[model samples]
Target: MFRVLIAVGLLAWTGLSRTATGADATDAQGEVDSARRDALLSQAQDCELRNDYADAERLLRKAAKFPADERVSAEILVRRGDCFMKRGKEHRAYELYKKAIEQYSLYIPFEGVVERLRAVAERFASGEASWFGVKERDMAIEIYELIIAKASSAKQAPADTLRLAQLQTEGDQKLEAVQTYRDLMKRYPKAPEVPEARLDLARLLLDLAKGGDGDGALARQAQHELDLYLQAFPDHSRRAEAETWEAVANERQANALYRLGEFYLRPSHSSVGAARRYLHDVVREYPSAMSADLAKITLARLDQKGIQEPEEAGQPQAAPVAAGVGHAAVVPPPIRPPDKDLTPEKAAPPRPAKTLQAADQVEKWLLPLEDLSEDTGEKAK
Candidate 1:
C-alpha cells in the first residue's frame, strides 16, 4: 500500500512538471529555445533537401518549441504537416495545418493552408477521410467555422458559410443551419453566393413547415422571401423554380385558412359568418392556388345551404396548375331567341311597252301556241 501511494504521487508530480515546463518555456527560457529551434529548423531543411523526410519530420518535431519568432514557429508546424502529408498521413497533416492557422503569422502560407484545409473538409464530409471506415462530418463543420472566424481565407467565407449550413442541415441540426444561413446573407449580402443562399433559406423554411407549422407561419416566411428574391432577380435563370416554390408557400397558407374555416363550421363550433369569411380569404388572397378552388367549392355550399354535389367523373378535372399561374375563366356563348316571321310571296305585273314592241316585231313568233295570240289574250283577260 505504501509503495503504491508513492508511485501515484510521483506520477502526478511528473505530469505537473511537464505542464509547468511547457508554460514557462516561452518566457523563462525564450532565448535558449529560440537558438535551439533555429538550429533544428536548419538541420530539418538540410534533411528535406536530401529528401530524407523521415529525419526531417523528427527534427521538425523537436524544433516545435514555444515562443520562437511567430514566422519560424509557423513554418515548423507547416513543414511538419507537409512531411506527414507526403508520408500519406493525411489525417495528421490536416491536424497540424489546422493548428498552424492559429499562430497568427503573416509568413504562414495562409492561402495555401486554407485551401488545403478546405479540401480536407470536403474529404471528411464525403466519408473519404476515414481511419476506421467512417468519417465524422463534424470535422468539416469545425474547419469551416475556423476559417470563417479567423478570416484566414476571407475570400472563401461566403461560400463556406453556405456549405457549412448545408452540412448542418444534413446532420439534422436544422435550427443551427437556419441561423448559419441567415448569417451568410447578413454578413455577405453582396456576395455572388447570396442569391443561392436566399433561395435555399426560403426552401429550408418550407421544409421546416412540413414538420409542424400548424399556423403556416414558416410557409408565410418562405413566401415573403421568394417574393423579394423574385423581384430583385427578375431575369434569374431559376426564376421559374422560385415561382414554383412561391406557389407552394401560397397553397400552404391557403390550406391552413381552409382548415380553420372548416373547423369553425363543425357542429361543436358553429360560426357561419366566420367560416364564410375565412373561405373568402383564401379565394381573394390566393385565387391561383389549388386550395383557392377548394375554398370556392366549400363557399358555394355554405351560401346555398345545401350539400354541393361531388364533381362528375366524366367532367374534366382542373389540369394540374402550371407553376400556379392564374388562369382566365372561359365564358360560354349567350342564347338567342328564334325569329317569328317565316313566310314568302309576290308576282310582278308585265310592262306595256315591252309587250307592244314584242307583238309588233314578231307577229308570227308572238302568235300564241294556239290559232290566235292577241285574240286569245283578250279572251283570257
Candidate 2:
C-alpha cells in the first residue's frame, strides 16, 4: 500500500512538472513572437513616415504573420491600412481594414475604420468612375456587407444595409438584393430607409413580372407591396410614382384573373361559375385594367350560350358622368347593340344645353362598351 501511494504521488508531481514546462515554453514563444512583431511594426512605422507605403505595407504584413499575437496581428493590419489610406489607396486600405476587423481581439480599431469602410463602399456605389470609367461595384458590395456584418451596432449600419442592397442590384444580383432589401426593412422597421427600400423593392418585383414568360408570383408580390406602400405613405413625395406602379400591379393581376377565367372556361375544365367569378372580379375589381374590356366580351359570350348571368354580375358599374369632374353620379343604361333602325343621334335625350352636353359625354363613354357586341359574335366563334 505504501509503494502504491508513493507511485501515485510521483505521477502527480511529474504531471505538474510537465504542465509547468509546457506553460514556460508557451510563454517563451509568445515573448519571441512579440519581439519580432514589435521590430516589424517599428520598421513599418519608419517606412510610413518616409512616404514609402509600399515598404510599410510589406513590413506590416510580416508583423501580422507572427503566431500567438492575434492582438498585434490585428494592430498590424490597421497600421498597414492607415499607410494605404495616407497614400490614397482606398481600395487597398479597405481590404486591410476588412482583415483587421476579422482579426480583431484586444486591438479595437478607431471609429474611423467603420467610416473609412463606408467611404470606400460609397465610392463605387455612387457611380464614381475609375480611370477607365470602371467602378468596383462588387467590391463596394463586399465592403458594405462587411460593415453591416462586422459593425452592425454602428449608427450607419442600417444605411450600409441599404447601400449593400443597392449595389447588389447594380451588380445584377436581383434575388440577393431582394433578400437584403427585405432584411433592411425587417431588421430596421422604423428606419428612414424602409420607405425607399419598400418602394424600390416593389418596382423591382414589378419589373420581374413583365414579359409573358415572367412569373405570376412576382406580380402578386408586387401588388401586395405596392398596396402596402400606398397605405403606409399616402403623403410621401413619391406617392405619384407609387400610384403608377400600383396601377401596373392591378393590371398584371387583372390579366392573371382573365387568363385564369379562360382556363376554367376550357372544355376540359368547363367550370362556368369559376370562369364567371374570375372574369367578373377582373371587370369589377380592376376595371381600369386593359383586360377589363376582354373580360366583358368573354362574359357576353357566356351570356349568349344561354348561361344565366351570375348573381354577382347583377350590378353593372356606374359609367362616367361627363368628361369633367364635379358632376352628380349617374348610372347609364346597359350597353346593348345599337338598333339598325335607331341611331345614338336619334336616341339622344332632348333637354337643356347642359343636359345635351352631358348626353354627348355619356354617349362617348358608351361607344366603347357598345362596340363589344360588334366584336363579341366574331370573337365567340
Q: How well does model 1 score by local distance difference test?
A: 0.78
In model 2, where do residues sit more than 4 Å from their true spots?
1-76, 85-91, 124-131, 211-215, 264-273, 301-381
What TM-score would you give candidate 1 relative to the actual structure?
A: 0.64
* Global Cα lDDT for candidate 2: 0.77
Candidate 1 residue pairs in clash (backbone atoms < 3 Å): none
Per-residue alpha-carbon lDDT of model 2 for 1-381, expressed as tens digits? Answer: 999999999999999999999999999998998898889889988998898999998998888788745666667777887787777677788878887777673475547678877776676665552555477888788787777877777777778888888888778788899999999889889888888899889888887677452336787777778888889888888989999998888888888778877876776655566677778888988898899999999999988887852354554543443443212222323556865656677676767654446546664456564456565654678
Please give the RMSD of candidate 1 to the true structure. 24.1
Model 2, residue 2: distance off in Å is 40
Instruction: Give Cα distance to truth, residue 126, candidate 2, Å.
Output: 5.8
Model 1 stretches with alpha carbons more than 4 Å out:
1-56, 63-68, 86-91, 131-135, 306-381
Best by TM-score: 1
lDDT of each: 0.78, 0.77
